[model samples]
Target: MKEYLKASSLDEALNLLSKDSQLKVLAGGTDLMVQKHAGSLSDVRFLDINALPSLKNINEKDWGIAIGALTTYRQILNSDLVLAEFPLLAQAARETASVAIQNRGTLGGNIVNASPAGDSLPVLLVYNALLELQTQKEKRNIAYTDFHQGYKKMDLRSGELLTQILLPKGNTWDRSYFKKVGTRKAQSISKVVMAALLKMNGETIEDVRIALGSIAAFPLRCRFLEDFLKGQQLPLLKREELDRLIEQNICPMDDIRSTKEYRLQIVKNLVWDFLKA
Candidate 1:
């Protein structure tokens, strides 16, 4: 392990990363610290980003919502404004490990980790979140769908820092909910998770979004399921239709935590249950 520079400002951190390609940015240090302790720390300089004040805020823009990268899950969960506007996100955040982890684990780290089982990723996907990345040159906003390119891989470049998450505003998403299957409630990791958001026109769903986690290489967002239910009246969307949507959207694999068949069946039931409610 090489001795790394700890920065006090975003510019200072960018300057180091821009100068040396070997510098890796560190925020929250939840995942990184654990990896380092396990002898998996990569040989590189660490650019500490904990001091960037701009990366610790939440603001509403004229067109969208801006959530700073360093904003902890606890802060998000406790935010009344977020609860009112993005209840699905709050619901998903509630299912994360425990209070202690929520107080320290950040939104940026969750996205960067790009885990298939990240509880909040599916919620972000439902919100159509975008990432604002800052570099020495300028700032760029990338769609969340394009941000995570693969498992543990992101589209972010060297010298760039994910500063904020942008979610569109003024859209009515009623019937938004989150569900997850875990061994126990507290501090337990999920075996399968799903998030659904819909806009209703009378009894028909006008627009909808559905995302599933822990069932694929990355959190899967299937707009097709939404499309299928677009014009279907609530009374017409039978349980069989909900079950068919799940099977069509996922081909899950059995893992240490759960069986593929079980996840599929549970996901199908969750959709049916939500629609029925």
Candidate 2:
């Protein structure tokens, strides 16, 4: 028989998790409920953590911002701090889904879902997001880049819950770009997504960070390309050099949403266009 439990407090939730490793956490339920309804989930136990108010806050720190895992996309869209400081993340949040989904979908759910096509992930990668995981015994932080070990897998332990996403204050970036290519403009899964931050010194590229999703097992940072572009004059940078580096970074596959060829070409074109502009 399927069992459901509601956690009255954070302590209660952690206790339940420590005891029952099989309990699937239920937060916003945007993805989980859909899976359950489609019969993908069977003979499962659910731990509803919606009652834990402590997990639903957005706080500013001297170093960066600590976003509670339970903070909904709606809250993110409405936060001025996010808009002014982390506009790339805010733009991704705005493009996540329709208003109704944004109201109910939590950032934590998106992270834990571990979809390669997740819209916010590339933005997080570019920002160098830190994730805080907690259990009854201890708490630890992990870099977002290292959290995903493979497709549909993460570094989370059995009893740990992702509690917060910490984003460090970004350096002064002269240019920022974010784009999500989906079947439709909104409420559609992305076929390919890219986010980039560039610090320019006159015409020379001082520093750059480029990240992409839906083209790899997990969201990827284009470190090879970033390293190649640094100190290169944008006007003189050649597409051939970029194409070579990008090819080394991602391994795309044919999926229902898009073909491998299309995804690869799109990413190359996006990067070229961003630099040229």
Candidate 3:
């Protein structure tokens, strides 16, 4: 038999974790429960985060939109404020697993799960979402890049629960889109996904953020590409330049989802096509 607990408060959750080294945090149970049932991971204790409603809202502040840890994918997609303001976020939320997954999967769990195929990861990366973590000792805010350490690994400590994802005040503007490649559209994991944020001045790109998923150990923003694109004339970057830009930036791998060569080619093509569009 397995031991489980439903903690109704953040303090209770942290206290429980402080006492048990093998305890697992269960928010939506979309990832942890499946992994446990599949025998990929197991725990002596389980702390269900749903009871802590304090962790379940999308708060709009003057600084930014604070996405609660327990906020579901569906909530994000359904938010008119989100759709109106951060279309990039809404765009990525649209690509998440399916209606079923979207209904149950949580934003915090997605970050903690650290899956390479997570659709929202690339979007959050582009928006510069800040990870809010809390424990009995103190609370801290970590940048998204710093929070995701590696595959299934994060900077979160045992007693430190992810409280919220604070997205900086609307960076998304008129030109931004999320593109995903999966086996099939409805309920498939991303084979490879990419997102771009562009501010163009006629034919020249003034600023942008490029992020890709399933291409590295952790999804990351393409600072190199963003830096290179600032005020660059679009017409100058043809197929070869686009290819070289991708080749110079992303270091993709040949995983079960795709070949390294294919990923490279796709990144190059997406950059060129999206910029042109």
Candidate 3 local lDDT, 152-176, one digit each (tens):
7789887788899998874545588
- Itemize residue pairs with steric clashes in candidate 1: none
Looking at candidate 1, the ten consecutive residues that score lowest on lDDT are 1-10
1-277: candidate 2 lDDT, tens digit per residue? 4589999998999999999988999999999999999998878899999888888988999999999999999999899989888999889999998999899999999999999999999999999999999999999999999998889899999988999999999488988899999888868999999999999999999999999999878888988888889999999988997887777776687899999989988999999978977
Task: List model 1 lDDT by residue over 114-176, tens digit each.
Answer: 778889998899888989998888899888988877777789887788889988878887788
TM-score order, best first, reads 2, 3, 1
- Residue 13 alpha-carbon offset, candidate 1, angstroms: 1.2
Task: Note the clash tally of each candidate.
Answer: 0, 0, 0
TM-score of each: 0.94, 0.96, 0.94
Best by lDDT: 2
The best candidate in terms of TM-score? 2
Q: Rate the local accuracy (lDDT) of all candidates.
A: 0.82, 0.91, 0.82
Cα lDDT for residue 83, model 2? 88
> Better model by TM-score, 2 or 3?
2
Q: Report the lDDT of model 1 for residue 234.
A: 79
